[model samples]
Target: MFSKVLVANRGEIACRVIRTLHRMGITAVAIYSEADAGAKHVALADEALCVGPAAANKSYLNIEAVIEAASSTGAEAIHPGYGFLSENVEFARACTAAGITFIGPAEAALEIMGDKIRSKNHVAQAGVPLVEGISEPGLSDEQLISAGEKMTFPVLIKPSAGGGGKGMHVVERPEDLGETLATARRVAKASFGDDTLFIEQLIRSPRHIEVQVLADAQGNVIHLGERECSLQRRHQKVIEEAPSALLDEATRARIGQAACDTARSVDYLGAGTVEFLVSDEEPEKFYFMEMNTRLQVEHPVTEEVTGIDLVEQQIRIAAGQPLSLRQEDITLTGHSVEARIYAEDAEARFMPSAGTIIGLQEPTGEGIRVDSGMLPGLVIGTDYDPMLAKVIATGADRDQALSRLHQALGGTIIHGLTTNTAYLQQLVADEDVRRGQMDTTMIERKLPDLQFPTPQQHHAVAAGLLAAQLKGLHPETAGNQEEGPTGWQPDGWRHSGAQNPVFAVSWQPPGTTAEPQEFDVIVDGSSRLIPVGEGRYLLRSSATATEVHLTAGEGSRQTGTEIWISSGDFTGALSVLDQEAATHRQLAEIEAELTEALPEVTAPMPGTVVAVGVESGHEVNAGDVLVVIEAMKMEHRLAAPTAGTARINVALGDQVSLGQVLAAVEAEQAENTESKD
Candidate 1:
C-alpha cells in the first residue's frame, strides 16, 4: 500500500479518492487549478498544491506541474481519477520516469488503448466480437461512401482517438455522410487534437453494458460483473445500474470472460472497463465498442452490487499484488442504481446551468451512497463539466432498489441552480425503465412523456408539499433553516415579535382553484388565508419580516438568510441582491430592453452557432433547430415556430444579442411565433 499518494484530478472524483485514501491510512495529496483553489477536493485532501491557472492546459492537464507536485510532496503513487490526464499516455510515462507508480494500466497499454482506431483493431485481432464497421487506413469520403454501400445505413463516424461520445456522429443515410463526416472531423480535431476517423455500423436499440476488470503486473486478471449504462444523453451516461436486467446468466458469464480475455491480451494492469453495445433484439447480441484504460465515472454501482471496492483493488494491483478474489469469489448481490445529478435544465434542452449552489441537502440512509463534488455556496461555473454528484442506492432487488432511488432523489435537495434531480426522478419511475425495457434510444424516444406531466404527478406534488410543510414544523427537521443562505439575507423574524406584520400567511391543502385549501393554523389566534399556487405556496406573514415556511397547515419554521437553501424535505431559498453602485450600472443596459418592445427573434444565450439550419425565406416547422448554439460545452438548439418563413438577419459567424432579432417572419405568421413563447 502506498504511504503517500497524489490525486491528479479535482472535484468529486478527487474527493472520492481522498476518502478512500484516508480509510486506507494513506496520506492524500491534491492538485488544483487557480479556479479550484477553494474547491471541495482541495479542502478534503491531507495536503494540497496549487498547480496553475484556471485553464485545464495550464493546470490539471499540465504534466510537468503534476509530476512536480508529486515529487515535492514525496508521493509514492499518482491516481489519475478519470478525465484530465487519466488516459494521457505521456503523463503516465512521466510518472514512471519520476519513479512514481501510476495507479492504472501501464504507459504502453495506455498508448495502445488511448487511440480508438488502434485499440479497436487490437481487440478485434484478439477475437473479441467488435462492432461491424470499416477500419481501413486513410479512407477518404469517396472510399467511405463505397464502404458504406457494403455494410448498412445509419453508420457511426467516430474519431480514432478518445471516447465519451466526443468526436462521434451518426449518419442515417448516404446523403448525410458529407456533413456528418465534416462535423466529426472538426470535433475530433478539437477534442483529441487528432482528425483521424473511422466508420462503424450503428446498432439500433443498443444497450451500453460495460464489464469492470482488475489485472496485476504478475499476469493475473479477474473480471467483475457488468454494469448497464443505457441511460444516457449525447453519449454521456445520466443513470447506471449493476447486474443488467437484459443479460442472462450465460450471456453475463460469456461477456465477463471476454472482458477478462481482452484485459489479459493487453497485459492490462490496475482497473479498467471493457464497454460493449448489446442489441435489444431477441437473443441479444453483444459487440465490443472500446476499452476505457482507466477507472470509470459510473464505477460505484458496480462496487455496490459486487461488494468490491475497485479503488482498493487498483491500489493493491498497483503495489504488485495478485488478485485477492477469483471469479468464483465474486458474488453478484442485489440490484443497485446510480443517478448522476448534474447542474442542468432538462426542460431547456439539457443545457448546463451555472450559478452558486445556495443550498445542498444530500440524502442519507442505509443502502444509499452520495459522492458529491459541490457543497453549499459553491459556484458552478462554466469552466468544467456540470455534474454535481452521483447518488447510488442498493436494495434486495431491482424494484426495491428503484423505490429507494426514488426516495433518495426526493430526499436530495439542491437549490440556487437548476438541476436534473426532478428529471432523474421521473426517469427512474419511467414505465419502460421500470420494466427493464431500456435501450440507447429509449431515453430519446420517451423523453417527451418523461419530461411532461403525468396523471399521478399532481398527487405526488401534493404529497410532497404536505410533507415539506410538516417537516418545516419539526424542531430538529432533516433540513436546517439555521444554515444561512449562501449570499442572501434571511430576515431576523424569530427575534422580532409577532406584531405590526406586513403580510398574513398560512398553509393550504389541495383545494378547488377558486376556494382556499383547508389549513387550520393561527398565529396569535387569528385565521389567515394560505395562498396555494399549483401544489406549493410561499408564505409571508404580516406578524414578521421573514417569510414563514408552512406546509399542510403546519407551524412556522424559520429559514436562514442566504440566497441558496436546500433541506431534504423543505427546499426553498431567497435570492441575494447586489445593491452596490457598480451592480446598478451593470443592470442599466438590460433595463432598457425590458422596457422596450419585444423583438422578432432572440438569442437564447451566449454561444457559437454550430449550424444555421434555416436560411432566408425558408419555410420551417415547429421545433426545428433554426440554429444550434454551443454554450457551456453543450449544444442548445434554437428552434423555429409552428409555421414561419425564416428571414435570417444574422450570418453563420455573426454574434447575436439576447432578445435580438436574428430572424423575422411575415406579420401573419409572426403571431404564431410569439404565441409559442
Candidate 2:
C-alpha cells in the first residue's frame, strides 16, 4: 500500500478515492482548480494543492501540474479517478517515468483501449465477438455515408477517441446523415482533440451490459459479474444495476469469461470494464462495444453485488501486489442499483442547471449508500460536469433492489437548484423499468411522458401562509419583502378593520412550465399558524387542522422566498411570490418575451464560442447550425429558428453570457427588379 496517494480529479469521484485511501491508512492528497478550492473533496484531503485556474485544460488536464503536485506532496501513487486525465496515456506514462505509480492499467493498455477503433480491432483479433460495422478510422463524410448505406439506415456516429457518450449521434433518416456526421465530428474534435470517427450499426432494443474485470501485474485476472446500463438519455447512462436480470446463468458465465479473456489478451493491469451491446430479441447474442481503461462511474453497483472495493484493488495491484483471490473465489451476492443524481433539469431536455446548493438532505438507511461531494453552500458552476452524487441501493433480489432504489430517490432532497431527482423517481417506477424490461432508448422514448409531481393546493397554501408569517415576524426587511399597500402596519395588519388581512401569493414548482398556482391566505389573527421544532409547523384552516413540516428562509428578491415543504413522499422547494414580487416578475417575463420575439440566436448558457458556421448575409434554413457554444465540457449548437439571412455578432473564442446574442437572422425576402427589355 502507498504511504501517500494523490487524487488527480475533482468532485464525487475524488472524494470517493480519498475515503478509500483513508481506510487503507494512506495519506490522501487532493488537487483542485480555482473553482474547486472550496469543494468538499479539498476539505477532506490530508494535503491539498491548487493546480491552476478553473478551466479544466489549465488544471485537471495539465499533466505537468498534477505530477508536480504529487511530487511536492510526497505522494507515492496518483489515482486518476475516471474522466479528465484518467484515460490519457501520456499522463499515465508521465507518472511512471516520474517514479510514481499511476494506480491504473499500464500505459500500453490505455493506448490500445483508449481508441475505440483500435480497441475493436484488438478485441476481434482476440476472438471476441464485435458489433458488425465499419471499424476503419478517418472516413470522410461521403465515405461514412457510403458505409452507412451498406449497413442500412439508423447508424450511429461515434467518436473513436473518447467515451462518456460525449460525441455520439444516432441518425435514423438517410438525409440527416450529413449534418449529424458534421456535428459529431466537431464535438469529437472539441472534446477529445481528435475528430476520428467510425460508423456502427444501431442495434434496436439493446441492453448495455458491462463486465468489471480486475487484474494484477502477475497476470491473474478475474471478472466481477456484470452491470446493466440500459437506461440512458442523450446516450448517457442514467441508471445502472448489477447482476443483470436479462442474462441467464449460462450466458453470464460465457460473457464473464470473454471479458476476462479480453483483459488477459492485453496483459491488462488494475481495474477495467468491458462493455457489450446485448440484443433484447436475441439474449444469447452479445457484441463487444469497448473497454473503459479505468474505473467506471457506475462501478458502485458492481461493488455492492460483488462485495469488492475496486479502488483498493487498483492501489494494491499498482503496488505490485498479487491477486488475493482467483476467479472461482469471486461470488455474486445481492442485487444492486445506482441512480446518478445530476444538477440538471430533466424536463428542459436535461440542460445543466448551475447555482449554489442552498440545502441538501441525503437518504440514510441500511441498504442505501450515497457518495456525494456537495455541501449546502457549494456553488455548482458551468465549468465542470453537473453530476452532484450517486445513490446506490442493495437488496436480496431485483424487485427489492428496485423498491429500495425508488425509496432512496424519494428521500433524497436537493434544494435551490433544479435536479433530476423527480425524473429518476418517475423512471424507476415505470412499468417497463420495474419489470426489468428496459433498453438504451428507454429513457429517450419515455422522457416525454415523465411528469413531475404537481404541487397540491394545500401545499401551496402552506407555503404562502409560511411566507406571510415570516414577513410579519421580520417586518421592515428591505431585501426580500414585497411592497405592501401604503399605511399598512408592519404587524401584517391594516388600519381599516373593514378590510380583511388577505394575502395573495403564488407558488412555482421547479422545472415546470405550468403557471404558478395562486393562493389567498386569510390571516385575521384568529387563525393559528405556529412553527414547531425542526422545520415542522401546525396550521389551522377553516375546514380542518393539519401539521406540516415546512422550512422558510429569505432569498433574493428575484428568486422570491425559498420554502421547503414536505407532504408525504413529495418534498420539494416552492418559490412563494407575493403580489409586488409577482408583478415585477411578470413584467420581467414580458420584457423577455419582447426581446425573444426578434429573430436572434442567443447563448443558452454561459460558455465560449467554439465555432460560427454562418457569417453576415449568409442564407440559412431552419435547423441549420449557426454557432457552437461549449459549456460544462459539452458542446451546444445554436440552430437557425427559420429560413433567414444571418448577421453574425460573436466570433470564435469569445466568452458569452447566458442569453447573450450571438447572431441575428432576418427573414429572407424575395428580390424584386425592373422587367428586362
Candidate 3:
C-alpha cells in the first residue's frame, strides 16, 4: 500500500478519493488550481499544493504541475480522479518515468482505450462486437462524406479522443453532415486536443449499458455488474444505476464476460468501464461503444451494489497486487441509482449557473449517499464542470431505490444559485423512467412534459413571511409597532413604509423559458414565519397554513434584487420586480419601447466564443444559430431572434459575461424606418 498518494484532480472526486485513502490509513495529498484553493477537497487532504491558475489546462490538466506536486510531496502514487488527467496517456507515462505509480491503467491501456476509434478497432480484433461504422483512423471530411452517402442516414459522429459525450454529434440530414463534421472537429481539438473522428451507425431506441471491470498487473480481470446510463441530455448522462433494469440474467452474464474479455485484450489494470449500446427491442444484442480507461463518474452506483471499493482496488492494482475478488464472488446485492446535481437552472434551458453558496442542506439517511463538492461559501463558477454533487440511493429493488432518490432530492437545498434538483426529482418519478422504458434520447423527448412549475401562491406566502420575520415585521418578532405604517428593510432592499406590507415579486423556475410571473403577497400580520422544526417553515395563507421547505436556500435577498426560495422539491429565483430600484427600471422600460426595441441577443452565461455562424451584414431569419459559446464544457448556440441583417458583436475566442451582447439583428423594417428618419 502507498504510504502517500497525491490526487491529481479537484472537486468531489478528489474528496471522495481522499476519504478512501484515509479509511485505508494512507496519507492523502491534494492538488488544486488557484480557484480551488479553498475547495472542500483541499481541506479534506493531509497535504495540499497549488498547481496553477483556475483554467483546467493550467492546473488539473497540466501534466508537469501534477507530477511535480506528487514528487514534492513524496507521494508514492498519483490518483487522477475520473476527469482531467485520468485517461491521459502522457500523464501515465510521466508518472512511470518519475517512479511514481499511477493509480490506473498503464500507457498501453490508456493509449488504446482512451481513443474511441482505436479502442473500437482493438476490441473488434479481440472478437468483441463492434457498432457498425467507419472507424478508420484520420479519416478526412471528404472520406466521411463519401462514407455517409453509401451508408444509412443519421450517422453519429464521435471524436476519437475524450469521453463524457463531448464532441459527439448526430447528423440526421445528409446535407448537414459536412457542417456538423467541422463543428465536431473544432470541439474535438479544443476538448481532447485531437481532431481525429469516426462515424458510427445511429442506433435508435438504444439503452446505454456499461460493465465495470477490475484488473491487476498479473492479468487477473473480473467484472462487476452493469450500470444503466440511458438518461442523458446531449449524450451527457444525467442519471445512472447499477444492475440495469433492461438486462436479463443471461444477457447480464454475457455482457459482463465481454467486458472482462475487453480488459484482457489490453492487459488492463485498475478499474475500467466497457460501454455497450444495447437495443431496446432486443435486449440480448449489445454492441461495444467504447471503453473508459479510468474510473467513471457513475462508479459509486457500481460500488454500492457490489460492496467493493473500486478506488481501493485501483490503489491495490497500481501497487502490483493481485485481484482480491473472483468473478463468482461478485454478487450485486441490490439496486442503486445516482443522480448528478449540477449548478444549472433547469427552467432556463438547463443553462450553467454560477454563484456563491449561501446555504446548503445535503440529503442523509438509511439508504442515501451524497458525494458533494459544495460547501457553504463555496463559489461555483463556469471555469470547471458545473456538477456540484451526486446523490445516490440503494434499496432492495429498483422501485425502492428510485423512491428513496426522489425523496432525497426533495430534501436537498442549495441557495444563492439555481440547480437541477427539482428536475432530477421529477425524472425519477417519470412514468417511462419508472417502468424502465427509456433510451438515450428519453430526456429530450420527455423534457417538454416534465412540470417544473414556477413559484406558486404558497411559495410567495413563504417568502413574504420569511421576509417579515427577517425584517422584524413578523408578529413573533419583539419589535413594537402597534399600528400605522411600519418600515420593512431586508438585505439589498430599501426601506418601505406600509400599514400592510406587500411583496411584489416575480419567479422563474429552472428549465422553463416563460417570462417571470409577477406574484404579490400581502403581509397583513395574519401570516407569520414560524419554525415548525428541522429547518422547515410554515406559511399562513389566510385561514390555512402551508408547510414549505424540507430545507431552505438563501430565503432572503442579499446581493441581487432577488430572493432564492426552496419550496418542497422546487427552488426558484424570485426577482424583486416591484421594489425600489426595480420600480424605476420598469417605469423606464415602459416609457421607451425597451422590450420590443431591444434587438441584440446576449449570452445567457459566461464563456468563450467557439464559432461564428454568420458574418456582419449577413441575412438571417429567426432561430438561426449565429454564435456558439463553450462554457463549463458545454456548448450553447446563440441564435438570431428576428428576421434581419445579422450584426455580430463578439468574435470567436472572445470571453463573454452573463447577458453580454453577442449579436444584433437589424430588422428590415427598423432599418427602413431608420433610413426614413
TM-score of 1: 0.76
Cα distance off (Å), candidate 2, residue 349: 1.3
Q: How many backbone clashes can be found in candidate 3? A: 6
Compute each candidate's TM-score over C-alphas: 0.76, 0.90, 0.93
lDDT of 3 by residue, 336-408 (tens): 9999999997767889998888778899997999998888889898999999999999999999999999999
By lDDT, is 1 or 2 better?
2
Worst 10 residues of 3 by lDDT: 551-560
Q: Candidate 2 on 248-295: residue-level lDDT in tens?
A: 999999999999999988889999999999999888889999999999
**Over 4 Å off in model 2, which ranges?**
474-487, 491-495, 498-504, 507-517, 524-559, 562-573, 582-601, 617-624, 640-647, 664-677
lDDT, candidate 2, equals 0.84
Clash pairs, model 1 backbone: 358-564, 469-551, 485-562, 488-563, 490-561, 501-542, 502-542, 503-541, 503-542
Could you tell which candidate, 1 or 3, scores higher by lDDT?
3
Predictions: Cα RMSD each: 9.2, 4.2, 3.4
* Candidate scoring better on TM-score of 1 and 2: 2
Worst 10 residues of 1 by lDDT: 503-512
Ranking by TM-score: 3, 2, 1
Q: Between 1 and 3, whose TM-score is larger?
A: 3
